[model samples]
Target: MPVTDVTTDPEALTMTLVAEFAAPPERVWQAFTHPRELARFWGPPGWPATFTEFDLSVGGRVAYYMTSPKGERAPGAWEFLAIEQPHRFEVLDSFTDERGDPVEGLPSMRTTYEFTAVDGGTRMTNVTYFASNEALEQIVAMGAVEGSTMAMNQLDLVLEGLREYAQGKGTQTELLSDTHVRITRLIEGPRELVWRAHTDPELMKKWMLGPDGWRMSICEVDPTAGGQYRFEWEPVGDTEGEAFGFDGETVLVDPPRRMVTTEHMTGTDYPSTMNDLSLVEEHGVTLVTVLIEYPDRDTRDAVLATGMTEGMEASFARLEREVMG
Candidate 1:
């Protein structure tokens, strides 16, 4: 089992568990932050988890349920209180009803997860703080320790499969759910430079053009929260294509790390979508990841059916050649 030690301090009203993994901190962090990865082991062997909503931002909440072999569900929710990137995060965890509201009479706990680099791998310290001694005892009596161990023990297989999942793949698309899709591309460039290429309008105009026959007619970028951005594209000489543009305002911005924005096609009544973009650098290459949340399954399907993935791949290839190259 990954969890090697479990300790309870009644006086402190805290239960701490330490787990070690044979992987780096980033990979372990990803396992917890990404709903798809977390679902693989979030529940014990017999039960599987399905995250209905996963928002990895401060003040955002995550709602999920674990289904038993007999089709019973145990719902849970987390209110994110703090986040410090690849090191630590804190959340207010509670048992909830089917609607994701905290259940009355059930004990709620404050949980913190910390990751540290160790000799050969990463060590994760998970601590849960109860409101009182009675609360701590109540959870302990409910097989909290055993359940946690079983859930964490299943993380090894998930961790082991991550490297093989994305190592050599170029720009790849993953259908995270009916309304959510994740697209990732590992580009041959540093994180800061890649961020610049994305936020700088001049640089964006050069390589953001998808195919060879198109040109960016207008480009306006503001990579800050509440700032608006617009991009218009038209066919170049003799090319057959109509003009199109997109408009959106930045919702959240964490420079060189992450950004969340609302996006919609300009002048269209189509519902807007939220897109979360993140950049992580490893081994001299930066992985650009975008998680898009569509309004509904129909809209998601319609967008993906528009050769979106191919166009993104072409633009990313252009980014590598014309900009980063």
Candidate 2:
């Protein structure tokens, strides 16, 4: 559910996808570069993937294939051009024949993968460049956009499993008072990065999402005091026209330090709430504290009963990765 945006620019000859995972850079990196993990999520839903070769070093080459439900196999290869551990890498990917050779006259793309450590997780931005605008259009017309989106969605699920196996921990929440609830975690990055990720809409879109099959369709943020922000979540799948949205006004803002906002969720019966977010750095990590205060005890209890904490925890976990890289 961490895939926030997928876009194509024929004029720029590029296809870009921005996603975040609730796992550290190292863990996310391994999921991407390791053959076993890559095979688990490289294909879209209903397609099984198999990786015959995977080498992460510069000049390395990888071969893989995805078997469709009808048993048809589509093969591909990656010619790695550059690599930086737990951060970024570049590769030239292309379709391959049965012999593992690039198909003649087929369009190939040079992909750049950037991994950033944000709060406690990692944000991955993938940009694929074609040799020409025509080549970009060709692939876009061939359903690359839809296929890649589904594939990345699978990666989000894969990351959750990987984190559970490696960390053996789930998100924790605390009820501090009758009207206040708090969620705190030590994000694996500097305070500044966490601050920017929270305040900037571009960064926020990389991770903030609604429930499964739903995404933030609208995001507008003005981070200064007295400024306002808005977010709208709409079902991206077959939800039969269901949508929800929210907006907020910034009461106060201090870079890398503190922020106070008054938020309202539309189409909901609960009253507006006040949110206080504070960030502090210890060693090289950032400790993020979020306190939510409802208008009254009943309102707080009503909101809690709606299962908001689970979504909030997932959002924060993804936010952690958005800032770390």
Best prediction by TM-score? 1
**Steric overlap count per candidate:** 0, 13
Worst 10 residues of 1 by lDDT: 160-169
Q: Give candidate 1's TM-score.
A: 0.58
Q: Which ten residues in a row have the lowest lDDT in candidate 2?
A: 162-171
Instruction: For candidate 2, give the lDDT.
Output: 0.77
lDDT tens readout by residue for model 1, 1-325:
5889999999899999999999999999999999988987898644568899999999999999986533468999999999998999999999999878899988989999999999888999999999999999889998898778878976886787534435567789877567778788888889998999989998998899877899999999889878999999999889998999999998777679767788999999999998877776765778787878898999999999998998999999999898898
Q: After superposition, how far is residue 110 of candidate 2 from its true place, in Å?
A: 0.6
* Highest-lDDT candidate: 1
